[model samples]
Target: MTSTIRPSSVFLVSGGAKGITRECVIRIAQRHQCKFILLGRSAIVESEPDWAKDCFEESGLKKHIMEHLLSQGEKPTPMCVQKVFKKISSSREINNTLSRIKQAGGRAEYVSVDVTDALAVKEKVAPAVKRLGSITGVIHGAGNLADKLIEKKTEQDFETVYAAKVKGLENTLSYVDLNYLEYLVLFSSTAGFYGNIGQTDYAIANEILNKSAHLVKQKYPDCHVVAINWGPWESGMVSPELKKAFQERNIGIIPMEVGAQMLVNELDAANHTTAQVVVASPATPPARELDSKLRTYRIHRQLKLEDNPFFMDHVIAGYPVLPATCAMSWIINTCENLYPGYRLFSCTNFKVLKGIIFNEDLADEYILDLQEDSKNNDFNEITFSAKIWHKNLAKKNQYNFSGEFKLLREISPAPTYDFAKTPDGNKINENREVLIPNWEDNNFYQNGVGMLFHGLSFQGVKRFLTFGKERFTAECCWQGIEAKQQGQFPVQWFNPYAVDLSTHPLGIWLQHFYQESALPAQLDKYEQFARIPCNKDFYVSGKIKSKTDINLIVDFVIHDLEGKVFVRLFGSKFVRWFY
Candidate 1:
């Protein structure tokens, strides 16, 4: 449907004296000789105002006024400064805007009306409609921002912010005749669309406007109702500190002229029946930025027992479960895809929330959501709260695993560590008394760690060394089977198979100490100090830090023949299994 308004149409705009509303009025007036009734809370003054020429020109005036207020021994708080600015400059601003509209060949008038008050809005709007004829368009741009972290916001702050947008739109709707209205535009914000850090109240208020617009459109089909979710504009509303914050996040501020032009184009086209439309520039440096607040990346894989029949060999309690190491590998693979040059430096708070069980009848879909955290650029750290959920499961508990991962530049310096040594200042030799001699020659396929031949290709331990009651050391070799199986060499810092094999000593330590089989339940801190070679021998050493009835806390490291550490698992944990 064509949603066009004539030049002689009557338009009523709220918060119309300054900022975005003023810019819209100026743009519309330049194209159409419409009658505009500008509504604002500040009373109009008859004085010629020099500051009215430019919105930012009042900075010097505000500084002078603040100095005078201070010289009079008064505290110049934000409220005090605003009250003084409004008293001295509000009238000139209103008068100047009206003059500009008239010069653009549009008839204009200003009225001081509290739009949140239904009776006041009706009282003012009724007279304007009677004087200027039926209202053709209404722009509800009135909004107040009480930006505070949700925890710090009080009841009064929420009410104040809500009054201008939510309450003001309600009052305006009550007075305006929707049947005669050709356009009803609500200026919403991106805060409501995607949310911002300290804009809880503002987000709620604008979201209400967006939903209300949809409801209004159902009743007034002919009248175009739209809520434009706008980003921060380069205006007085955005402070320098706020601008810098947005810049750091790669969020671009909408230019004043560009925003004004968008408003005109939307109203002129009149083809928008969707009720909600977003008007904002794409995020700068889009590579690292996410389109949504919570980014979910997904992968679907059918667990076929026939295709990889060896997976059935790693069953626990008769149920086939994906290995924890493979899960970590999948997450690392995703991170590598999202951030090409960055590598996983450390993973902490890793927990097996629930075990994923496979079914032959249905294919399983896995979901990975990486929530962006407050970044610390000084450390070159990009932290994310990562989760892997089983999407095909009908059970209420869908999360298979959850953890926090940090990615750093591959060029970052490796961590330095002093491995435990002997009193003679030489590396500790494998104690022959406790060592398992000819471990590789034993029937590992029948009597070994739970991993079978196919699993062993990735998780086979070659030798055991320095075995003791609470501490042990062992050697594992990466066969590069992952490269052969997948037909491509993995460039990840830590080989998943090699890393998993290194943890086998922890299971041996658990069997020797607790006399039971155990599985890795949680990993607190896993750090990769350097990249491991594809097909090379690596040493793993671990020591028990503490032991509970069911859990053992251990620290382990994976290093090369030269004793250069490749990966370290600190504050690691294993849970003893009964079945």
Candidate 2:
């Protein structure tokens, strides 16, 4: 709260050229008629405070009086300088700021210097002592008050406010010369004492400066160091809404000058005893006297709730885990034909969850779901048949598994679509099998149309449908001419054909699509898994038809604990079963 720093007799006012700090500087300087050094971010070499001009412009101003007094003119008071600054602030255009100052008869000058740099302050600011003949006080009024919460605050945001205030204060204290510096006035705020709601971090940073106020005062005995806890004032920082709001509270608005004057008034007493003072338009109530419910900053500390052991247990065990799994299931199985809210794989959530049996210590809140799903009710027992492998399961050593199949307790609804190929007029070709040439373009387009146009039938894959148009398509059968998928009765037109599918991608891509995502394990007896077209078009079976006839990949999803998924599949026209 030290308003000014005195060197010899002149007082160095930090941020003395603008804002509430300006008035504080002028009032103290003119009152004592002591020379002053006003500081700003920019340089006075380019401009000087308008008071310097008005002093030389008007007839009765200070400079005019000094020169003409002996010869006989009257002397104007310090009020002559105040008019210049007021007009500049109200000027409609920035270009007229200096002109308005001149019209009102004053001068404005600034010396280039970054106030935050201590070395710069010691050089540019301390030298003002000799230039002005003496320095009396310094007001550390240059600071900021931005609003941001801790959670949202970033590194740059916190640095901006800290640099202007904390750095500015550190710069000022470096020059507390007893013979020259008499007062140290810092424009602190209530935020420093009681952390602001949205500015907890900012307030904590300011407290670092506040806590050292006494030490600063003790170090500089001649310098009166005052810490002002400023409240909402009608300044650039105050919103229009706040101005109107505070007006209704019957509290008086301090003209920036009054707030400045408060600092100046306290500067005179920068002694060993009086180190801190709060400057606010409306005094706050005693600490801890306010209602706890009304306090927003103490939310974490003021939490109140009844002890619910079950709720606590749920939190520890992760209550929303099941819900998250259910969401994923719904997204992956959107086309499942179930009731509005009920889904097919939805029950799978309970199945896997049964694996994680909570101890007896599991909370009642979690136990509430026991009756919800009868299958999940008995958490003590949840197991499925392990996968068994044969000595030579597949042509490859790595790919194979055997599972004891479990029959469904009840059959679900029938499928939504039917396929009929034998009739006279049907979309399906009368031939049970069809094969395109190994280099046929028609084969690629028909199979890749879904992949290239709307997108892949699986996980939205964009494949080489055109293959650079350099004859991208082809057809190759898995078996000999006589080994094509055969029908129950020989119909001349009802023969399945083969298209060259060699270039097709054979890989795994996790996708959400209805159908058997993979060929039935790997055919152990045959070197490769075979996809044979059945006589019945759309009958549900382990057999998959992937040629020009059905236009499908080895797509299937086994409804078992062990899952094998695939899409964009390829196989042969003739495949045999291992009976």
Candidate 3:
């Protein structure tokens, strides 16, 4: 359907005071003398202060202001810096934008309201509607980014990122009369379409917008509901470092003028067709090939124990630490992305050099470095040494884990064997007088071990067979919740959650012998013979090889009810955390 905007049409733009929205308003106003209502969170000042004006025109004003704050024994935080700049800078920007719109023969007004607050949005829009007549079109451009890995995101971080686009749209949609609304445009991002490495929350938020646009279009067939999944644009949002990173991946940044023009073009082509469109520059090959010997990728993450409540179940000694299996899954997933059509077969010489402890307030950044074997000649088979290091802003990078991993094009079938028929050499009967009837009744795991939290189906231990402190065996059932949660297309062999459950006997032994919980610090060798299905009961057996003041070395074998050994971990060391 062809559509045209009248000179007297009322247009509402969220996040309109600055950035892309401001640019769009200026461009649209130049075309027609429309009535525009701009909504933003920042308040407009009556007049720009002298210092603010000087700061806007002068080059060294920001540095001088920061230095002055420091001299007064005040910390110059992000909030403080924004406060100083907004006092003059933001007001000047809004005023200049409004002045330009008026000069182009358009009438514009700004309203200060948090778009996430439904009542506040309703209150602001009602007055604008009464004054400018019924709202005809809307451009929902409000969004925020909290770029953190899934493991590092907090509940607050998720809420903050989600509220900008998802909740903001919900609040505005509640006030708009969609029956007569001419157009509804949403500014989405590529992160939602192709998942980014460290933008879990942001991707979720934008994907919601894209889906909502389609649903809204179905209801209001005449109204143009379009969600544009845009790539990186040269704006305040794109940092220099981020631009360089995107460049390295052969992704081009859209120019501001080009992006603004694309928005107008999409609106003009209002056919009520194509609910979502991706506007991105053509990809190009990297300027230089990465070194075959070494390659490294860095990611910043803010891990919070409370973000994913299930993670709290894997606690050790009153502290939450990431399980080794989870770390391995991350590494394997990364490799799969780098090399398509290949999967990780097994990891030899696997080791957890250090435990990653979750901090309540601060998030940890990590660097994954890969070293390729120059001697190997096989093109299909790749052998590489992988190391994961936690970046310490103040101190040196702390080593977390290191191992040798192998990727294969395809895996062989599982060999047949029956583990249930094997004789139990150190079995402790459940009915025995000395052994505890219920595994949870044992004080050793309940009181001493912090990692074994209740309600965590994947890490639940059904029964424990203790043959003194030197050896132990446990039975664990796969609850099948992990597969449902992960939603993996083709099920993977050696489920990471299953691997974690199978290794619980080691933690139990550590508490039994030392009266203190320990973390898996090092694994000298781990070999996976075959893939284990998630819908099966498994047995874990561990034998303590040696013990020291701060470390315990153990060998573990994980097998199914059919007596088939799926994986074997030898010379795995558990280290005590004194802190």
Candidate 4:
């Protein structure tokens, strides 16, 4: 972890004299007491004019200017009054920024140089670096906006917005020596990353800055080069009408203090891998394009015992086998990542074709292949098929897992189905003997104490509420260690440990009624109505739908304390496991 800024660091900042950038400059000066060479296009008045010197307020200055115009025999047009007001106000703002930085125990100097002019930038910045010392950091925040659709925009309109960001960055970096630089912060906009409707030129210019940041970071591996894609801030740029519209649409506006602190935090952070990032509230509109092109993606993975300590708890018959729920987690998490704005609604036809057993002859790596099947743009739904396999010289396709996943743009409402009570409203069949485990040991899944073989991590059955021929319910809690619990994979949408416990009732019923233990074979469907509750007591109810000599099919439902169904596993088939 390296400190990015020091008291002796010299930062050349563009567009740092006003607006959000000025706040960041003031904060940096306060924290590090570093010197700043602030650049801007506006030229400030060294002193107020004689007649307007007495006026401090904006309205008073305007009145004096109007009276002075009348005495000089000139027309005081509305446009003339506004033009003078802007100059005086801008000069006052620049002077205040400089004074604030100095008050924060930092030295500062203002340079009126247009960043878009490469020769002028070189002429102004080279002399400042020579006198102050070698440059250590650069904050490029200069930008202009020409908000218009491409059809209505003129060529000059595009250049006016594009020159300030793209050309300005190129001109500023040309004279600085990158070998000794420690930080490079580029102020980009969310309109560039997630394109806005009327900001084509601005988006294009800022995106170039983003790509340039990545390129520079690769060359200077030690420098913290980050391009922040900031959303709209509470500043003079956002008009009242625009602010009202943003509120109506539930979009977020960044406050001035918060946005400034984010810049300082980014510089102070020790992470060097993050080169481009977005800094915005969660309400920022994401880029959603209904791309229907068919695509196939492949990702490779390798599993080892040393990397996955949690697998030690799941050993069956002297070997650690990958759990079916964890395998499903891989497909669900990968699909969600491939499509940014969609979540896994349900997974169907999920089967464990071959369980990945951790043995001496395990393959070096496995490949996960995913292919898009269909997409419905109207409903914002998509379907894809995925399989985990390893190439073998003798075999053609050795798939370890396969499933079809459906993703939805929004989560479905929590289902209202009671799994606790029987549908026919019949009392429990008490004639059938109830099988209960000893409370002292709580060893339902221990190696020899119980029929099933599972270690402490998978032992989630705390106590049984009811056990009968037709239905059985049990209280369960997540007892597994959270750190690196999913073996080689990580938990994403839902906890696999909790999901694994939901199926335990099915296995328990088999051992109680038929004197046999079963393992999950395949799943007919898994629908997530709501998120599973953690750090609290939840219940799982399993009702036997059908049974045969070879297998048993059951329906398992997990619900919260209020008896609202959160997850439903329909037609879960399990085959008897013989020891």
Using TM-score as the measure, which candidate wins?
Answer: 4
Tell me the lDDT of model 2 at 543: 26
**Candidate 2: worst-modelled 10 consecutive residues by lDDT:** 295-304
Question: Considering summed lDDT, which 10 consecutive residues are worst modelled in model 4?
Answer: 424-433
| Model 4 bad stretches (over 4 Å) | 1-4, 50-64, 236-251, 281-579
Clashes of 4: 0
Q: How much does each candidate deviate from the true structure in C-alpha RMSD? A: 17.5, 29.6, 20.4, 9.1
Best-performing candidate as measured by lDDT: 4
Question: Residue 212 in candidate 4 has what lDDT?
Answer: 92
How many clashes in each structure?
1, 79, 7, 0
User: Of the candidates numbered 1 and 3, which has the greater TM-score value?
Assistant: 1
Candidate 3 lDDT tens digits, 1-579 = 445778878888889879887888887888767878899888888865444445554336566667767978999886786677665567778888899899988888888899999999988778878888888888898888777778999999999989999999988888878888888999898888876767888888899999999998898878888999989988847779889978866578888888888787887774658899988743322323223554555444445555444456665556666767767766776766665445576687778777676755233566677766532224455666788787565677777778888765545554544333322333445453124333445443464344344235455566664345566666667666644344321235446777777766666555544556556777777767766556566777777899888887888877765556778788887776553
* Better lDDT candidate (2, 3): 3
Candidate 2 wrongly placed segments (more than 4 Å): 1-8, 42-109, 176-180, 244-252, 269-272, 281-579
Q: In lDDT terms, how accurate is model 2?
A: 0.38
Task: Identify the superior model by lDDT, candidate 2 or candidate 4.
Answer: 4
Query: How high a TM-score does candidate 2 get?
Result: 0.37
Candidate 1 per-residue C-alpha lDDT over 403-483 given as tens digits, one digit per residue, 9 for 90 to 100: 988887534555554554332211233443233432334233345543232254455566555666667666677666534
User: Would you list the C-alpha lDDT of every candidate in the order shown?
Assistant: 0.73, 0.38, 0.71, 0.80
TM-score per candidate: 0.52, 0.37, 0.50, 0.61
Off by over 4 Å in 3: 51-55, 58-82, 281-579
> Candidate 1: where is the Cα deviation over 4 Å?
47-84, 281-359, 363-579
